[model samples]
Target: MSILLVEDEAPKRKNIRSLLEQMDLLGLVSEACSVGSAIRSLRSSSFDLILLDMSLPTFDIVAGESGGRAQGFGGVEVLRYMDRFKLPTAVIVVTAYPAFSQGDKEIDLTELGKNLEAQHPKIFRGIVFYNSMFSTWRDELKTKIEEVIIR
Candidate 1:
């Protein structure tokens, strides 16, 4: 199966790739370091799964842009694009912040998840935190990926 990995930080991406390799789920992996590149990758190829980082740089290096500021909702933009196009690829959202931890009442992940699901059901396979104080994220990620494979 094909997988698209979208992450901005080099070290984090490397770590995730290592984890996937350990899980024996690292097949045909492709990387996108920014929102623009992720979207372009989506347009160019079909993937069975996408490991998406919520925060990413604004510009796409593959498109000749060197660097750009981080876009806070870069992953959301990619999701919206997939939902708009009705892409069949399953997405697993990875983030450092807790989904409901945002103080903003209207902008928190709870609201975002609800709104997105209302529009495009079954688009998200899971939302996993890369770091958590009370949960084992790595274990959860492995479980979720296994479930995806079964599906």
Candidate 2:
């Protein structure tokens, strides 16, 4: 299966790619460092899965400015675009807000997930947090991927 990985941080993206490779599921994997890049990649090719990050320091190619990180929903816009165009790719949101580093000011993303599902059902397969600082994150991600693949 093909996969599109959307993330901003270089090291994080590298780590995820390594994990995907180790899992033996890295078939035709593509990377996008920003929202604009992700959009461009999607427009050019079709993917079976999209691994997304919520907060991104995206650069808008058209606007020549920042895209969604300030408003704190970069992945939301990408999802909306996919819905608008009826892209038939499955999405899995992986984030690290309010859980690992947010301290006391962490925002609950479940509501956002619910809203997305309400607006566009069946596109989002799962939502997983980036608790990868610890040891179990790899296993969790693997499980989620396996679950999605089976579906």
Candidate 3:
């Protein structure tokens, strides 16, 4: 039961991987850098939980940070993409999208959870937030991943 980690930053990815290993979860941590890689990973293997980075470099992170993309995507784009799957793999969109309250049409965490649970059932576990500057989220993700793995 691997925990798929889809993040682009080397430092953050390393730090998160370290924490997961510390929790006796090294074998359960898999990494990916982009949407294509992530999708491929999902297709080729099975993961208990997906620790995603909502701010993918796909839409030009530079442009997204500077406010340019039409979709205003960061991590939520992953969620929107998940919704399209007829046999969608279970997913959790780990992101830092701003102004994405529960009411917004955009891909919010609460909505994403509901969608995954409702649409994908057991395969779609849940989500965990990512904090680039801190390892707290990494530890928290380890706990969440453990729950799914143990189940």
How many pairs of residues collide in each model? 0, 1, 3
lDDT of 3 by residue, 66-135 (tens): 3233333344555555555543444555555433534445666677667656755645666666777676
List TM-scores for all candidates, in order. 0.82, 0.82, 0.63
- Model 2 spans > 4 angstroms off: 60-71, 99-106
Per-residue lDDT of 8-59 in model 1, one digit per residue for the tens?
Answer: 8876788788888987767779999888889999999999999898878877
Model 1 per-residue lDDT at 119: 63
Q: Judged by lDDT, which candidate is best?
A: 1
Candidate 3 C-alpha error for residue 91, in Å: 3.3
Q: Specify the poorest-scoring 10-residue window by lDDT in model 1.
A: 98-107
Selected candidate, larger TM-score, 1 vs 3: 1
For model 3, give the 10-residue run with minimal summed lDDT: 59-68
